[model samples]
Structure formats: structure tokens, C-alpha cells
Target chain A: MTVLAVAEHRRGDLRPVSYEVVTAGREAADATGGDLHLAVIGGDVESFAEDLNREGVDAIHTVAVGEEFDHGVYAQALTQLWADVEPSLLLAPNTVNGLDYAPAVAERLDIPLVTDAVGVDAGEELVVTRELYGSKVETTLAVDADRAAVTVRPSEWAAAEGHGDATIEPFDADIDESALGARVTGFQEVGGGDVDIGEADVLVSVGRGIEEEDNLDIIQALADALDATVSASRPIVDNGWLPKDRQVGQSGKVVTPDVYIAIGISGAVQHVAGMKGADTIVAINNDPNAPIFDIADYGIVDDLFDVVPALTAEFQ
Target chain B: MKVLVTVKEVAAVDDEFEIDGLAIDDRYLSYDLNEWDEYAIEAAVQISEAREDVEVVTVTVGGPDTEETIRQALAKGADRAVRVWDDAIASAGLLDPATKATVLSAVVEEEDPDLILTGVQAADDGFGATGVTLASAIGWEWAAVVNSLDLDTEAGVASVHRELEGGVEETTEVDLPAVLTIQTGINDPRYASLRGIRQAQSKELAVQSLSDLGLDAGALDSPMEQTSLYEPETEGEATVYEGSAEETAGELAALLREKGVGEA
Candidate 1:
């Protein structure tokens, strides 16, 4: 058995999830008693190969196709690589770009593909553990196939580090330019506004628990009382209650505030990805079983409508 | 021109719920149209409203119980609805993305729609792969996590802005006759009006089974099996404060002061 893990990059730099993918692939490879092979497509493959040469990696394959990701090019190149490598398991990141191409590769190869796996084990069978119903519950799926593909959830595994002596090889993927149906035009930076939540020392982040847009006044009042910056989860920004600059999540700004007070936030995984690095975390929600409490250092299980005003008074 | 939107009826568990065997108890679950699919439906409806001779049809893989949810899409301005269900589908256990793409591709074959839209991921299972998988199965173009779409049917191109991680958007152009997985915030989803609800009651809703779509029960066959379901153990060692709102707030305030918060 062999495990092939693909590295992800955007613009000019490799995303941090690429190292995490190597870690996940090494674990699967260890379980199956096989060697781990890494592949980096497009955008500075020579440098990416050198950087991806982690300790557990047995070999590195570089496919120099284009400067950036084109799903059509990826689908064709990965299929050709799959035919050559014939690995038992294929691992890819569960990023936006990964979702863009992994499905097509798996579908073209006629293999079972599981996305957003938090846990992967390859013993007698492949078992993948993932969250359902928005992280309210976890379920384990057993794949009854000899070969399968899995897209690993980011930040679940620690990054692979240290140097290795893996052999580097270049594979010629003759990508058909005419077969490409989609073309990348350009990239733009969104979320530029009056505030940069990333620099705040203290943040008062709100979520769907705020109920209505008009109710954001209480959150604002609380933030004002504590002299903290106002941030929000995806819903508030999606509702246009706050500008995109104030949103904190995977697609938003990653903030590492000193004191993070989560008011009415249930702490979904995507939202957690941004603020989990805060020094001290507090959660105020009515539901005790909310996942927010699982990471909070101090939690008050009460309605935000009652607690916000009361907590605001304490600071004032 | 025609647009096909994939809608799913997702089950959301209550704050406190019980897990019965490998699934949550029905008593503690409530069904609603997936959040992401709502955006997809709105995108399709907007396209229909903007052009001439355009029809927006919704396809769902659920039983009769989902008709009410499907009607919500019709009420939101979809022209019609298609529900694909069968006993084989019900007993298939886990309807993986591949199985779903297989089933939905058959409908694409029959409908021959020029554009297909689906949510980036279903709120329930969150597979986030069916739209792309279906596109590959049918050999059509696709884009994922699209937050903005500018479709020109005359030019056969759909310009989109894909929401990448860390506040970056990638602009891309996908050829028409493509499947784009819509992300939230693409557009404001409108609430169904009372008049629209009444019209939706009389709208056409056609149900098809595997055989009806020229597929057998084998189409539901999948290699994935859900073995267990359980709530993850809480890992936090937080010192939860117990008391009234005033009491808890007082405790938190003292701690915040100790941590040097709220000092001018």
C-alpha cells in the first residue's frame, strides 16, 4: 500500500494546510505499513518539493503545470498521476481549491471520496470520523473498498516538520489547454473597511444567537463598556449587520486577541478556526451543550438578552 | 434556457438531543431547507427573473415528507420541483455524494438544463462534493464555493467570485452548462410571500424513482457505511460559573479585572 498526499498553494506561497496534509498522510501510511509520497502541483513546484520533504515522506513528485490552480488542469494531471502511482489511498486538503478538484478526480477515477474527515484510520478497513449536523455529533464511516480518497479537515493534525532524504522526481503531465473549460481571471482582496479586527487586543464576537440585526446594539454597548473591538461570526456579516472586515472565521480574518468574549456565539468549527488562538476565552450562551463551551475557559450558561446588559453594567 | 437547482431538506438537532443507535432521535430533530441551498435557489430564481424564456426547477433526493420543503423553493419563485425517492434509496443507509451525483446526473440527462446550481455543502451531512461530482459524472464544467455569479446565457459564460480562505476572492470564468456550488452571502434570499405560497401550492411537482430515471437500485449502491454516531466528549476544563446573571457577571468581571481588562 502507498499513500499519495497532494500539497496546496495559492498565489505564490504554499498554504499551511499542506504540511497538515503531509502529517495526515504519514499517519495513514504508518497504519497501512506503506511509504508516503507527496505531490505538489503548479506554482513554484521546485521550492514546494524541497519544503514538503518532511521526515516521514519517502518520496516527492512534482508536476510543473501552471502558475496557479486550474481545476481542469488539476483533474487531468491528478488522473494521470493516479494511473502512474496507483496508490491505495489519496489524501488532499479540504480547502476551497481542494473541493474544486478532488471530486472531479475521484469521480473520474471511480473511487469512493470522503470530504472533511477529522479522523482517518486504515487497518483492515478505512474508517473516517467526521462531524454532522454542524458539529453537534460525530459519526464514523467505514469504507468497504480497496482504494479510496479522503479530503482532510484543516488544522485537525499537527504540521509535519524536520528534514528528510526523500528522492525528488518530475512527472510530465501533458495538460490539454483546449480541454480546460474554466480560466482564472484574477484575484481580489475583500473585507477592506474601517476596522482591522486582527489587531484588536480584546474582541466581543457575536453570532446567530443575537437573533435580529437590531439587537446588535447590546453587543455594541457591551463592546463599548469593555473598550473592546467588535467582531462577529459569519451570520452577522452575512446579514450585513457588520462589515466584512469585522467578521472572524475561516474565510474572514484570523484574530489572536488577548481577551475574547464570545457573546451568543455557538462556536462553529469554521468560526473557531479564526479565534481559537485568543489568550483567554469566555462564552455566554443559554445552551450548556453548545460547542462553544467546549473551548471556553469560563462560561456562563444564560440567555444573552439577560446576560449582556448585566455584564455590560459590571464594566461600566 | 433552463436552470436546475439541487435542494436538500436537512435535519437540525435541538440544543439537547438523544442519539438512538447510529442516528439522532426523530423527536429532537427539525427539518428545514439547507442554508446553502437557499442561496442556490435564490441565484437560480434571479437568473430566471432576469431573462426571457428561462425556467428554474429544483431537484431533491428525499421522500414524500420533503414535499413541503420542496414547495418552499417553488414559493420562492422556482418554476417547478422534482423529488427523487424510492424504497431502495430509503434502505441504502448512507446516501454518499457519489450515489447522489449518480442519481442527480440521471435527472440532468432527462432535463438537459443549461445551468445547474447547488449549495457548497448540505447543512446536515456537509459532504460539499455532490455538485462537482455530478458535473464530472456528466462531463460538465464546475466551480466550487462561488459567492458571486454573473451569468450571460447569450455568451455561454458564468463569471464568478470564489470565496477562498482568509478574505481572498478568486475571479474565474466557467463556460455555461456548468454546475456551480453557491456559497452564502451571494445574494439576499427573499422570504416567500403569501401570494407566492398560494401559487406554489398549485405548481407542478413531479416525483421520480430510480427506474423512472432509467436507473436501477444499483444506482444507490455505495461503498461507504456509517458505523457509529455519538457526541464528541467535551474537552474543555473551563471553570463554569453557576448563579444568576448578576452573580455570574460579577464573577466574570472580577476575573477580567485581574487579567487587566477594562482599565483606562
Candidate 2:
């Protein structure tokens, strides 16, 4: 059993998840007693391969194709590489770009595909653990196949450390430019507004629990009372109750405030990814089982409607 | 021009629910249109509204119970709906992305739409791979996690903004006859009006079986099998305050003040 993990890069720098995927791949390789191979495609492959040659990596394959990620190129390159390496298990980060091409590669290769895996056991059969229904429940899936592809969620495994001596090779993939249909044009930065939630000292974040746009007045009042900037989960911003700059999540701003009070937020994984670095985290929600409590340092399992007014009065 | 939107009926679990076997109890689960698909439908309808002779058809892979949800797409703006379901599909333990792409590819063959749109991932399964997999299965171009789309039918290209991590977006140009997985907040999905609801009742909502789409039970066969399902053990070590709202608020406020939160 051989494990091949693919590294991801955007712009000139490799994403952090690339290192985490190495750790995941190493673990899977250890379980199967197989060599762990890492591949970095596109953008400065030489430097990326050297950086990805972390502990437990046996070999590094670099494919210099494009500067940035293009799914068509990725699908073609990975599919061709799959035929060359013939690894039993292929691992990639469950990032946006990974999802863009990993599935197509899996389809072309005709293998079982699993995404967003938090846990992987590659003993007799590959078993993957993932969340469902907004992380309310977790489920484990078994891949009953000889070959499989799995995308590991970011931050689940620590980034691999220490250096290793690995054999590096450049694989020349036949990428037909005429066959590619999608082309990367440019990149843009969004969520630009007056408020920079990332620099706030205190944040009063809200979520769908606020119920209606009119009810956002209470949240604003609470933010005012605490003299803190108002931030929100995706739903509030999606509903137009708050601007995109004030949104906190994976796709939004990652904020590490001094004191972060989560009101009515259930702390979905994406939301927690942004605010989990806060110095002090507090959650106020009606549901005790809400994932917000899992990461909160202090929690009040009560109605946000009743608690917000009282908390506001306390600061006032 | 025809735009095909992939719609799904997702089951949202209640705040407190019981796991009956490999799924949440039916009584605790409420079915509704997938959040991301709402934006997909809205994007397709917006295109249809702006262009002439644009037929927006929604395709769903669900049972009869999902027609009500499919009708919601019709009520919003879709011209018609196609639902593919059969006993073999129901019996299939888990329809992984590959299996789903195989099933949907058949529908794509029959419909031959100029453009196909789907949610980035279903709310229930959250695989987030079906659209791109379907694109590869059918040998079409694809863009995933697309938050903005600028369609130029004459140019045969769709300029899209794929939302990346940390507020960065990558703009790309995809050739026509592509599959785009729509992300939320791309558009404001409209509420179905009374007149629209009345109209949707009479609109064509055709149900197709595996045979109807030139597929067989083999299309539903998947290499992935769900072994177990359960609620994850809560890893919370938070010091939960037990009291009235005022008391808890006082405790939290004191902690915040001690942390120098409101001093500024």
C-alpha cells in the first residue's frame, strides 16, 4: 500500500493545509506500512517540493505546469500521475481548489472518493470519519475498494515538522492546452469595508439565531454597550443584516480579538475556524449541544434574546 | 439556451434529535430545499430572465416526497422539473459523488442543456464533489465554489468568481456547456408569490426512473459504504454558568471586564 498526498499552492505561497495533508498522509502510510509520496503541481514546484519534504515523506514529485491552480490542468495531470504512481491511496486537502479537481480525477480514475475527512484508518479497508448536517452528527464511511481518494479537512492534523531527505523527481505530464476549457483570469480581494473586524479588541458576533433582520437592532445595541465591533457568522451577512466585511468565517475575516462573545451563533466549523484564536471565547445560545460550546471558554446555555438584553444592561 | 439547475431536498436535523440507525429519526428531520441550491436556482432564473428563449429546468434526485420541494424551485422561476428516483436508488446504501455523477450524467445526456448549475454541496451529505465529478464524467468544463457568474452566451464563456479561503476570489473563464457549483450569498433567492405557487402547480414536474434515463441499477452501485453514524462526543470543557439570564450575564460581563474588554 502506497500513499500519495498532493500539496496545494495559491499565488506564490503554498497554503498551510498542504503541510497538514502531509501529516495526514504520513499517518495513513504508517498504518499501511507503505512509503508516503508527496506531489506539488504548478507554481515554483522546486521550492514547494523542498518545503514539503517533511518528516516521514519518502519521495517528492514536482509537476511544473502553471503558476496558479487550474482545475482542467490539475485533473489532467493528477489522472496521468495516478497511472504512473499507481498508489493505492491518494490524499489531498479538502480546500476549495482540492474539491475542484480531486473529484474529477477520482471519476476519471474510477475510484472511491471521500471529502472532508477528519479521521482516517487505512487498516484492512479505508475508513473515513466526517461530519454531516452542519456538523451536528458525525459518520464513518468504509471504502470497499482496492484504490481510493480522500480529502482531509484542514486543522484536523498538526502540520508536519522536522526535515527529511527525500528523493525529488520531476514528472513530465502531457497537458494538452487545447483540451483545457477553463482558464484562470485573475484574483480579487473581497469583504472590503470601513470596519476591519480582524483588528477589533472585542467582537459581539451574531448568527442565524437572531431570526430576522429587524432583530439585528438588539445585536447592534449589545455591540454598542460593550463598545465592541459587531461581527457575524455567514447567515447574517448572507441575509444582508450585516456587511461582508463584518462576516467571520472561513470565507470571511479571521478575527482574534481580546474578548469574543458569540451570541446566538452555533459555531459551525467554518465560523469557528475564524474566531477560535480569540483570547477569551464566550458562547450564549439556547441549545446546549451547539458546537459553539465545544470551543468556548465560558458559556451560558440560555436564550440569546433574554441574555443579550441583560448582558447589554450589565455593560451599560 | 437551456440552463439545468441541480436541486436537492436536504433534511435538517432539529436542535435535539435521535439517531435511528444510520440516520436521524424521520420525525426529528425536516425536509427543505438545500441552501446553496437556492442560490443556484436564483442564478439560473436571473439568466433566463435576462435572455430570450432561456428554459430553466431543475433536475432533482429524490423520491415522490421531494416533488413538493422541487415545486419550490418551479415556484421560484424554473420552467419545469425532472426527478429521477427508483427502488434501486432507494435501496442503494449511500450514493457517493461518483454514483451521483453517473446518475446525473444520464440526465445531462437526455437534456443536453447549454449550461448546468448545482450547489457546491448538498446540505445533508456535504460531499461537494458531484458537480465537478459529473463534469468530468461527461467530459465538460467545470468551476466549483462559484460565488459570481457573468455569462456571455454569444462568446460561449462564463466568467466566474470562485470564492477561495480568507476572502480571496479567483476569477476564471469557463467555456460553455460547463458545470458550475454555486455557493451561497451569490444572489438573493426570491420568495415564491401566491401567483407563482399557483403557476408551479400546473407546470411540468416529470418523474423519471433509471430506465427512463437509459440507466440501470448498476449506476447506483457505489464503492463507498457508510459503516456507522452517531453524534460526536462533545469535547466541551467550558465552565458553564448555571443561573438566570441576568446572573449568567453578570458573570460573563465580569470576565470580560477582567480581560479588559470594555475598558477601551
Candidate 3:
């Protein structure tokens, strides 16, 4: 058995989550006692492949296509590569690009696929755990198929580390031009005037507990005093209180800031999935049983309306 | 041009969800259109309103009560509604995302719509597999989790921006007859008007079964079987600080300083 991992890159550079994909593949490969092979597919991605010389990797396959991301090329390349390698298990990031093509690749090859897996175990069959019902429940399914493809969620698995002298091999996907039905034209930032919370070092986030749009002024003030960027849960964005780009959750951007201040947020599983990587989490909520408190490094079980103002004044 | 949008109705479980064996207790559960599908319906309606000779049809697969969800889509501006249900499929156990896609692709073939749209993922299953799988099963180009969409009917192409992780977006252009799985916050979904709801009452909601579409019952089989369903284990336990609002803030600020979080 062989485990093939798809490395993700953006703007000709490898994203941090790519290593997690390798980590997932390493686990699968170890379980099956198979060699682990990683593939880096993009324009000028040769250097990106060098960054993935992890201890468990057996080899790296580089496919240069002179484009950052093209759905048609990606699907075609994966399919063609699968035909060549015929790996028992395939792993990819559960990001936007991976989801766009992973399912299609599975359908094209007639293989079983599971997306957004947070837990993975291999034995007689591949067992994976995924969330359902708005992230309120967990369901574990066993994939009995011989061949399976999985998209591992970011931040769930530890990034693959340690150095290895894996053999580097250049492979040509040899994708047919006629098979390319879609082409990437350009890239656009969402809302032109949106905050990039994913890159923030310190974040002061709000949620439905902020009450109304007018209440945002206080939260903004606290963020300003702390010199931190302001982000929010889905309700703030849905109600137009905050920009969608500022929303942090499973459906939104994943952030791993140095410090995350969650104010009045109940810490729904959907929201927690994105920010679980924060170095330090501080939660302020009146409800003692709110799930957010469970994950918070420090918690204040009091009304945020009173606590937020005091915090702002203290910071000032 | 005809557009087919897939919609699903899901139970709204509040705090303290009761799980009876493998399924949640539906006694206290209320039903609503899957939160994500509302964005898909809104996108379809916006396109239909902008383009001439375009009709938006919403479809779902479930029991008879699921028609309420389809009617909601019709009231929101869909020209027609459809429900696909068979007693046999219902009794065969849960329909996996693949099976759901197969059933939906059959409907797409019957309708022969120029475009098919659905939410990025259903709120219940959150598999995020149906739309893309349907596109593959039907041999159509597709883009998932698209935040922005624009179609040039004359040129037979659709341009969309897919929302990626880390706040980055990639734009792509797909040939006509494509499937787009819409993301939330693309646009504010409109509320159904009173008159539109009245009109929807008289509108026809066609129901189709597997036999009607000439699909085999085996198509409903799921490749994977769910062995267990349970609540995830909670991670770190919290150390709650009890004090007045000002005292709590003071303690929190000191802790942050020790942890090297906020500016000191």
C-alpha cells in the first residue's frame, strides 16, 4: 500500500496547512506499513517541494503547470497521477481548492471520499470522525472501500516536522489541454474594505451577545485600546454589523493569532473549529456553561457589557 | 434558460439536543430551510430577475412534509418547486451524500437546466459533497463555495470567486451548464412577500420518484456506514474567575500580561 498526499500552494508558495496534509498521510502510511509520497503541483513549485522533506516522506513528486490554481488542471492532474500511482489512500487539505476538485476526482475514479475529517484512524478499514448538525454532533464513519480519498481539516493534525533526505522526483502530469474546461482568470479580495483577521497577532472578537449594531462601538473601543484587530462570529456578519471577512469560524477564515479575546461569544463548535489554534484564549460570557469557556485559557463568567468597558478602561 | 437550485430542510436543534440512539429526537425539533440553501435560492432568484427567459426551480428530496421547504423557495421567487421522495428509499436507511447527488442528478437530467446551484454544504450533514458530486455525475464543470458569481448567457460562461482559507479568494471562469455551490454572505437573502406566499399556495410542486426518473434503487446505497454517533469530548477545562466586573477585568489584564498577549 502507498499513501499519496497532495500539497497545497498559493501564489507559488506553500501554505502552512500543506504540512498537516503530509502529517495525515504519514499516519495513514504508518498504519498500512506503506511508503508515503507527497505531490506538489503548481507553477514554480520545485522549491515548495523542498520544504516538505519530512521524516516520514519517502519521495516528493513535483508537477509544474505554470499556474497558481486551476480547477481543471488540478482535477486532471490528480486523476492522471492516481492512474499512475494507484495509491490505496490519498490525502489533501480541506481548503477551498481541495474541496473543489477532491470530490470530482473521487467521482471520476469511482472511489470513496470523506471531506473535513477531524479524526482519522486506520485499521482493517479507514475510520474518520466528522462533525454534523451545525457542528453540534460528531459522526464517525468507516470507509470499507479499497481506495479512499480524504480531505483533512486544517489545525486538526499536528504539522509534520523533522528533516528527511527524501528522494526528489519530477513527474509530468501530461494533462490534455482539451480536458481543461475552466481557467482561473484572476483573484479578488472579498469586500474591498474587509479585515484580514487570519494574519492578526491579537484579536478582539464579538458575537451575538453584543446585542445590537450600536453596541459594536464598545467592542471596537476595546479592540482599539488593546491595539488589536476586531473580528466576530457569524451573527455579526449576517446582521451587517461586521464584514464577512472579519468573521471567524468553520465557514469563515481560520485564524491562529497569538491571543484571541472572545467577548460575549458562546463558542459554538463551528466557531471554535477555526480559532482553536490561538496561543492564548480569553473568554468573557455571562453564561457559565457556555462552551466557549471550556476552551478559554481564562474566563470571566460575568456580563460582558460591564466587563468589556472595564477591560477597555484598564487597557487605556 | 432554466436554473435548478437544490434545497434541504433540516431540524433546528437548540441547547440540550436529545439523541435517541443514532438520531436526534424530533419531538422538539423545528424544521426550516437549510441555512446555506437560502443563499443559493437568493442567488438563483437574483440571476433569474436579471436575465430574460430565465426561470428558477427549487428541488429537495425528503418525505411529504418537506414540500414546505420547496414552497418557501417558491415564495422567495422560484418559478416552480420539486420534491423527490420514494417510500423505498426512505426505508432503506439514511441516504449518503453520494446517493443524494445521484438522485439530484436524475432531476437535473429531467429538467435539463442550463445551470445548477446549491449551498456549499447542507446544515444537517455538512458533507459539502452533493453539489460537486452531482456536477461530476452529470459531467458539468463546477466551482464550490463561490462568494461572487456573474454569468454571461450569450457567451455561455460563468465567472466566480471561490472563498479560500486564510482570507484569500481565487476567481475562475467555467463554461456554460455549470454547477456553483454558493457560500453565505454573498448577498442578503430577501424575505418572502405576503402576496408571494399566497401565490405559492396555488403553485404546483411536482413530486418525482426513483421509478419516474428511471434510476435503480441501488443508487441509494451509501458506500460508507456510520458505526457510531456521539458528542465530541471537551478539551481544556476553564478556570473561571469570580469577582465584580472591574475586579475581573483587572485580573484578566494581569493574566494577559503574564501570557504576553496584550500590550503592557
Candidate 4:
């Protein structure tokens, strides 16, 4: 069985999640004793091929569509490439571009697709583990198809690493211009001036338990004292206490910081999905039964008003 | 303009689930419309209210218990609802995503909707594949995680902005008769009013089974079977910090220093 991993890129640059896709593909390949092939589909992705030379990759196929992340072009290209390679398993990042084209590719290829894969194993039978109910429960599935297409969730698998001597091959796929009807016109940043919590090394994330808009000053002060960035759950943003950019959850930006101080956050499944990847999590909530404590590295059951000022002074 | 909005009912996030024989224990679990689909319903209603000659319809695959959920959408302003269920499918076992998409696409073919809307993913399954796959099965242009949408009925085109990771929103123009999976925070889903609830009792809710749609029971046979369902393992149990607010704060700061957070 040949396993193909699709590399995710933005414009000409490759995204970090591409390596995770490779890791997922490598795992499937190792389990099935199959060869692993990685593909990068974008204009000027040759350099990306060199960057993607991970140790377990058997070969790297670079398809130069000579365009930005065009959905139609990607679907057509993958379909053509799948026909050429006949891969038993196809893996792609469960991202904006990947989800856009993966379904169409699966349809065009007539392959069963299992998406948002958190855990997958190719044993006697193919099985995958996925989260449901906002990450509250896990469901395991056994795919009956011999050949399957899957989208691996971001931050679930560790990014692929180490160097390899895999040969880079340029793949030419037949492009159908008429099918490329939808066009990506532009990209805009929501709440442009807000801090990007995704890039923060340490985050002080507030939640609904923070009470009201005026209390945000205390959280901001704590962030300043710790020299960390400020983010929040959906309620904070929905309440207009913080900009949407500062929100972290399933609907918001996913962040993987070194230290995540979840102050007054109740740790809802959607909120936890975004920050669960943090190296160290410290949740401070008055509610001892808060689900955030399930995954928090450290827990503090206390009122934010009393804790925030004390923590701010201590950090200072 | 005819619109088809898809909705799903899922266990609440805080609900603890346990295996009751073959299925999860539902006695203590409360169900509501999936969070993302609420936004889809709201988007459908807003769009319908904005344009003249627009009607919003909803569809879901569920047993008889799903009628109340369907009625919730009707109260929220959907013109009609279709419940896709058949005794043959229920007896055959759980339906995989491909089968669900096939069933939904059959409904789409019957409705021939100018627009199809579904949540980015159901909170229950979290596969997030049905909308895109349904679009593929029916041969329609589609976009996922759409936060902003504008439909130009006259030109048969829809302009949408998709929310991507890292705070980026991509604007794209898709032709009408397309599918859009709405993201959360697109709009606030309204609570059903007393009048709307009373009026929903008389609204058109057409329940169609697999055979009714000319789809065979074999089509609903799921290739994927659930081997297990359980609470996911946690990496490590949380270590609680004890003291007064100030003392605990001091301890936390010292721990952060030891961990080398913030260049300590």
C-alpha cells in the first residue's frame, strides 16, 4: 500500500501543520508496511520540497499549479495525481484549504473519506479515533474500504522531523480551467490591531467567569505583569470584552503556547480544543468541578478578583 | 430562492456519556441543536428575510425523536423540514459519513435547492465532512467555515468570507446553487418566541425515508463501525496548588520561574 501525504502551504510558504500530515502518513505507512509519499501543491513549492525532506518520507512529489491556494485547482490536481499514484491511503491537513478540496477529490476519485482524524492505525483493520460533543467524548471507527482518504486534525500529531535523502520529483497534473470557477479574491484580518495569541509564548486567557467588561483591566494587568499576551474564550469576545482575534477556541485561533494561564476559564470543550496543546497549563477557577482541571497541569480554585491582583503583584 | 439548511442534535458538552450496552447512555444527557448548526439556521433565516421569494428548508437523518429538533428550526423561521429516516436503515446499524452524505445528497436532488447550508461540522461526530461531501456528491461549488456571506440572487452568485486559522479570513466568490458550511459566531441564533412556537405546529414538516427518496437501504449501510467509545485519556492529572490567594500566586510565579516561562 502506498500512502500519500498532502503538504499544506500558504502562498509560496509551507505551514507547520504540513509536517504533522507527514507524521500521520509516516505512522500509517509504518503500520501497513507501505511506502510514504508527500506532495506539495502550489506555485513555486520547490523550496518547500527541500524543507519537507523528513526522515521517513520515501519520495516527495511537487506539483506546481502556479497559483495561490486555489480550491478548484487543488481538487483537480489531487484527482489527477491520485489516478497516477493509486495510493491506498491519502492524508491531508484538516485545514481551510485541505477541507475545501479533499471532499471533491474523494468524490472525483470515488474513495471513502474519514475526516478530522485524531488517531489512526492501519492494523488488521483500519481504525481511527475522533472526538465528538466538543471533545467531550471519543469515538473509534473501523473503515471498511481498502483505500481511504483522511484529514488529520491539526496539533494532534507531532510535526515530522529529521533529515532524509528522498528524491524530489516534479508531478504534472492536467488542469481544467473551467472547473476553477470560484476565485479567491483577497484575505482580511479580523480585528487587525488585536494581539495574535497564537504566536504568544505565554498566554493569560480569560473566560466568562471573569464577570464583566470592566474586569478585563485586571486580566490585562496580569498579562502585562507576566509580559504575556491576553486571550479569551468565546464568551469574552461575544460580550465585546475582547477582540475576536484574542479569542481562542474551536471557532477561534488554535494556540500552542509554552505556558497557558487560563484564569477564570471554565474549560469548555471548544475552549480546551484550542489550548490543550500548551506545554504547561495552569487553570484558575473558583469552580472546583470545572472541566479545565481535567487537562490542566496545575489547578487553583479561587476567585479571579482575589487571585488576579495577587498573581500580578507576585509576577512583578 | 430556495435554501436547504442542515441541522443536527448533539449531546451537550458537559454531559457525561457512558456505554449503555452498545450505545452511549442518554438518560442523563440533554440534547440541543449542534452549536455550529445553530449559526447555520440563523444565517438561513437572515438571508431569507433579506430577500424576497426566498424560503429556507432544513433536513436531518434521525429517528422519530428528531421531530422536536426539526420543529425548533421551523420555529426559528425555516419554511419546512425533512426528516430522513427509514426502519431499514435503523435496523442495518449506524450510518457512516459517506452514507449520511449520500442520503443528504438524495434530498438535495429532490429539493434542487439553489443554496445548501450546513454547519462546519456537527458537534456530535465532529467529522466536519458531510457538507463538503454532500456538495461533491451533488456536484456543487462549496466553501467551508464561512463567517460572512452575501447572496446576489439576481446574478446567481454568492460572495463569502471564510475564517481560517491564525485570524485570517479569505474572501471568495462562488456561483449560486452552492453549499456553504457556516462557522460559529457568524450570527446569534435567536430564541424561539411563543408566537413562533405556536405557529411552528402548523408549518410544513415533510418526513422522507430512504425508499421515499429512491435510495436503497444498501446505500445507508455504513462501512465504518464503532469499535469503542469512551472518555479520552488525559496526559497527566492536574496538580492542585493550595494556599491563600497571595501565597498561591507566589508559588505559581516560582513554578513559572522554574519552568523558564517569560525569561525568568
Off by over 4 Å in 1: none
lDDT of 1 by residue, A1-316 (tens): 7999999999989999999999999999999799899888998999999999989999888999889999998999889988898899999999999999999999999999999999999888999999998899999999999999999999999999999888999989989898899999999998588788999999999999999999999999998998999999998888888988898989999999999999989989999999999999999999898888998999999988988899899988
Task: State the weakest 10-residue window (summed lDDT) of model 2 chain A.
Answer: A237-246
Candidate 3 C-alpha lDDT tens digits along A129-241: 88876556788888888898888888888999998788888888888888677888777655635567888999999998999999999999998888899999987887788
TM-score sort, best first: 1, 2, 3, 4
Q: Between candidates 1 and 2, which one is better according to DockQ?
A: 1
Which pairs of residues have clashing backbones in candidate 4? none
Model 4, B1-264: lDDT tens per residue?
Answer: 889999887766443446665466767577877878888999999998988888899998887887898889999899889888878866876566677888998898899889999998876677777888888888888998898999887887889999887667889999878999998777878999998898899998888988899988788766678878777675549988898998888888888888776564
Candidate scoring better on lDDT of 2 and 4? 2
lDDT of each: 0.94, 0.92, 0.85, 0.84
Clashing pairs in 3: none
Error of 2 at B150 (Å): 0.5
Each candidate structure's TM-score, on Cα atoms with residue i matched to residue i, is 0.99, 0.99, 0.90, 0.88
After the best TM-score superposition of candidate 3, give how far the Cα of residue B127 lies from its true spot, in angstroms.
1.1
In candidate 2 chain B, what residue range of length 10 has the lowest lDDT sum? B255-264
On lDDT, the leading prediction is: 1
Provide the fnat value for model 2, as a fraction from 0 to 1: 0.90
CA deviation > 4 Å runs, candidate 4: A194-203, A208-230, A238-241, A249-259, A264-280, A285-291, A301-316, B13-17, B242-264
- Candidate 3, residue A45: lDDT: 71
Clashes of each: 0, 0, 0, 0
Tell me what TM-score chain B of candidate 4 gets against the true chain B.
Answer: 0.89
